[model samples]
Target: MNLTQLNMLSDAQLAARVAQDIPDGSYVNLGIGKPTHVSAYVPEGREVIYHSENGILGVGPTPPPGQEDLELIDASKRYITLAPGAAFFEHTDSFAMMRGGHIDIAVLGAYQVAENGDLANWATLDETYPPAVGGAMDLVVGVPTIFVMMKHVNRDGTPKLLERCTYPLTGLGVVSRVYTDLAVLDVVPQGFRLVELTPGNGFEAVQAATGAKILT
Candidate 1:
């Protein structure tokens, strides 16, 4: 089936969906790219402390236009605001927070994710651009829960949720859940377990889009 025919969630909508699942009173890190959008949609009444690997805690939503602080940015180098009681520290301290298990969750983007929860977001086969793993390795090992936010397929219409990742693994069996444009899935011992389908998307359609079998 053609992807355009499916009523897939927009990036903002997908972010909001992921935001709704995050528990209150958690310290979370949003990976660069699509995952960064999740920060702006945290549900009201919940207190989620956002952490930037580049060294900022209590990260807030994106600042309104004309209110941008050129000096303030997240790991993605995108302009951001600070929530109340925000703090800044050196990179050493920032990494320590990530590596010391102080972070509760890490929402990251991915190139591919295997059925067994293997993540391959850091590097791909394309040699044009240098591979940058960033803090993903640290977060996957230290943070208790890992939520991946990414498109369900590549530009060529190949699935990103696969039986086995074709790219280099960032961390073995690290992903807890995956939120894609079509559906939400949990990494279970059996494989990709369908948690929920995006509105207007059917089970079979989503399964066809996925490279691996999605357990009901």
Candidate 2:
């Protein structure tokens, strides 16, 4: 089945889905780009302490218009507000929080995710896109649970969830779950396991769009 025929979740909807699974009191680090949106959709009654690689320990949602704080930005350079009790420290210290296993969950955007939980979000083989490893290597190693948020397929309709990554890996066997526009899946010892599908999407259709086998 062609992916274009399926009713996929929008980026905001996908982020909300990811947010629902984050347990209360989780110390999470949101990766750049799409994963950053998860911070805004955290479920009510849940308290998630967001950590930024740029040195903020209590990252908040995007500020309202006319309330932008130019000096306060995430590693992605996007303007962000500070949650209550937010703390700032040196860049090295921020990395320490990530590398020292202080973070419980890390939601990351990915280029390719192998069936065995290999992540390749940093660098692609495409020459036009420059490689940037950033703090991903550290997060995947230190964070206990890694949630990958990304599109199920590339712009050319090629699957990003693959049998093996074609791009440079950020970490091996680290991803715990993946939330994509098409479906949610878990990376188990055998391979990708189906968790749930987007509304109106079928398991066969999603599996057809995936580059690797998705076990039921």
Candidate 3:
């Protein structure tokens, strides 16, 4: 699929695509944006544990409409149900888990990613909206694997996966994989490797639309 075609996928479908890549028994942190949708699509009975920076672990699916507890929400502040062994603690303990390398995987959203795996997703140069880095830095540096979930192209048709990032850097050489609407790419020493593409996408079509080179 091309960039335009990718935009047509429903949010639930996009979330489901991301769900397929998460491994069983992995401890994962879902970033604030689109990455938070990942929990709803994790395959049933997989035993994957979801963590929230707000100090909750083993988070389950979204709660029923009228059952949301104001005090119990995920990092996205969305109402969520707790898993059987879920626990909650102080925020300081939460940061410790993230900064101390306890997380196995982190799924994040990105504004730009360089060929060599530099990431810049928090802010743009525009001052209209204030940018917040939040727990992203902690996740990138402490987690063993970082997966970025985002669109392939910017609003003006600029490629987000690039030869070099034009936005402010978030983490250097830390990204492990990229799950875009068009394809899934693994970040390797040689650069982004094309592991899989959507139903209608071709390798050449994806290459022409991206700034980074894909391993054939």
User: Which candidate tops TM-score?
Assistant: 2
RMSD of 1: 1.5
| Worst 10-residue lDDT window, candidate 2 | 1-10
Assess each prediction's global lDDT (C-alpha) against the native.
0.91, 0.91, 0.86
Error of 3 at 39 (Å): 1.6
lDDT of 3 at 45: 74
Q: Compose the digit string of candidate 2's lDDT tens values, residues 4-49.
A: 6888899999999999999999899989889888877888899999
Model 1 lDDT per residue over 1-216, tens place: 478766689999999999998899999998988888786788779999999998999898888999999999989998989999999999989989998999999999999999999999889898998988888898898888999999998877889999999899999999999999999999999999999999998888899899999999
**What count of clashes does model 3 give?**
2
lDDT of model 3 at position 75? 88
Clashes of each: 0, 0, 2
TM-score of 2: 0.95
Residue-level lDDT of model 3, residues 1-216, one tens digit each, is: 245544335557778998987899989999997988887788887888889999899888887889998888888888888998999999889988988999899999999988799999888988898988888888888898999988877777779999889888899999999888777898899999988886677777788779989986
TM-score of 1: 0.94
**Would you estimate the TM-scores of all the predictions?**
0.94, 0.95, 0.93
Model 2 lDDT, residue 97, Cα: 86
